[model samples]
Target: MIKFAFCYEHDDTLSFVKNEVQNCLRQREIEISVLCCHNACELAQRAHSGCPDILFCDLEQDDATLRSAIMNVKRANNRLICVSTAASHSAHAEDILLEPLYRMPALNRKHLWRYAALAYEKILDEPASFTYYVRPSYLRVPVHEIRYFASEGRRTHIISADCRDTFYQKLDVVEDLMRHKNCRFMRIHKSYLVNASFIAGFSRDYVLLTTGERLRISKYEYYQMLTNQLKSLKNTKLRYHPSYSEW
Candidate 1:
């Protein structure tokens, strides 16, 4: 069943999102369960029983609180679909619905329903698309290109294979995804979430990545991964794990 959580600033706003979600679910005959939160802090308790497939929050809530809630959803393995007035401002969300309706300052029912249906369609039919999630800066590099992750002050940098395009993503989210045992990602450092298919060699404390970048590996995690999780990645056809080392 698809589950959803809605956190809004007002009752009318909550009603609008709910009505839209229900209308879409009913038409598709999809079973769904829902929980509602009036503010960001209230989200924690509502989502405690189980994670939602989507979460919607208003920008009027405190920024710190909203960010906390977003982080919580990510940590809980939940994908977010936000509803807000400013699409540009809420660029962080995976999906955003901007409503021009001022009557009750609520989301447009048709738009909201269409968005939810589309989300469900994507999740069910295109789960493999997540592999391309590497940031745009890294896209220019060859897929087999190995890289380094290092931290400076407060940010994490993706040192390129050629030591040039050192793009960065915050360390927090990277660290969170690393903790999942079933997740295909492995953490070579506090700042990196390396895809297992990228590793070319391993010896003692270091792993030689396909990008030819050598990175330190936690001894415990290295052993655990090698013995348990690494094979599943290799068996999958997600990426053509090229046999040639110098691709």
Candidate 2:
């Protein structure tokens, strides 16, 4: 279920944004489990009380408290996907926030759908489940919960924060599907495909995921590529681990 909250200073802009968001989700066929509409001050009062899973807000609005409040919630919850509706250059500054779904001049349907599609992929909704079959029956697992996929012999194991599932599949097949799905994953080794959000730290030979598990990097070239990728990212607004070697 995806709970969406909207915040904006202007009433017309808020309504338009809400409408666009609904349309985008409908196009993706993702149902909004909980919908909230709020102005800057109203959201500021309850931003920390219970933050939504996804937030669409005007970061460039003339409200510092609202911006700071939303940002604080984002810092506290790494799973939360916040998309900005601001079109100005200042709102897209490096220090503002790490946004994945927002595009400049995003007041239209097409851009909004792209953002919604991203949110849909990341949401813990049932429709975004990763499916596997065992004979005649099929099991579905929420894509967001999956931490990694590993192959052992001819069977593939799916690891999530909640559970582990094993099924007959190839890691290569899983990797290919995940890439086409635009999932937040990286192939650190031939046998392992890890969720990018679960990654906590990095060293030359291994990646330390947030689940307190370390996965080995198979090759020096792959390690370097991942290191470069991590350096170019601000997804977590994080600094690399102090032990991380430049090489």
Best candidate, lDDT-wise? 2
TM-score for candidate 1? 0.44
Best by TM-score: 2
List the candidates' TM-scores in order.
Answer: 0.44, 0.48
Model 1 agreement with the true structure over 1-247: per-residue lDDT tens digits: 7677777878997888887888777765667788888876788777777877666666644376766765676667634444454433434442332211111144577557645654553334322222112232113333234343455544555544454333333455434423432334566555455656566776656767776777776666655565455555556654535221211
Candidate 2 local lDDT, 1-247, one digit each (tens): 5677877667887787778878866654556854455665676566556667788876655566666676676777656777776556555344336444454366667767656655655454333457664443446776667889999987999998788878866787567557534245678898888877678787778888776798999998878777776665544342222223232
Candidate models: Cα lDDT each: 0.54, 0.67
Error of model 2, residue 77, in angstroms: 3.5
Which regions of candidate 1 deviate over 4 angstroms? 60-62, 78-85, 88-106, 125-247
Residue pair clashes in candidate 1 = 145-211, 146-211
Clashes of 1: 2
Residue 221 lDDT, candidate 2, scale 0-100: 85
Output the worst ten-in-a-row residue range by lDDT, candidate 2.
238-247
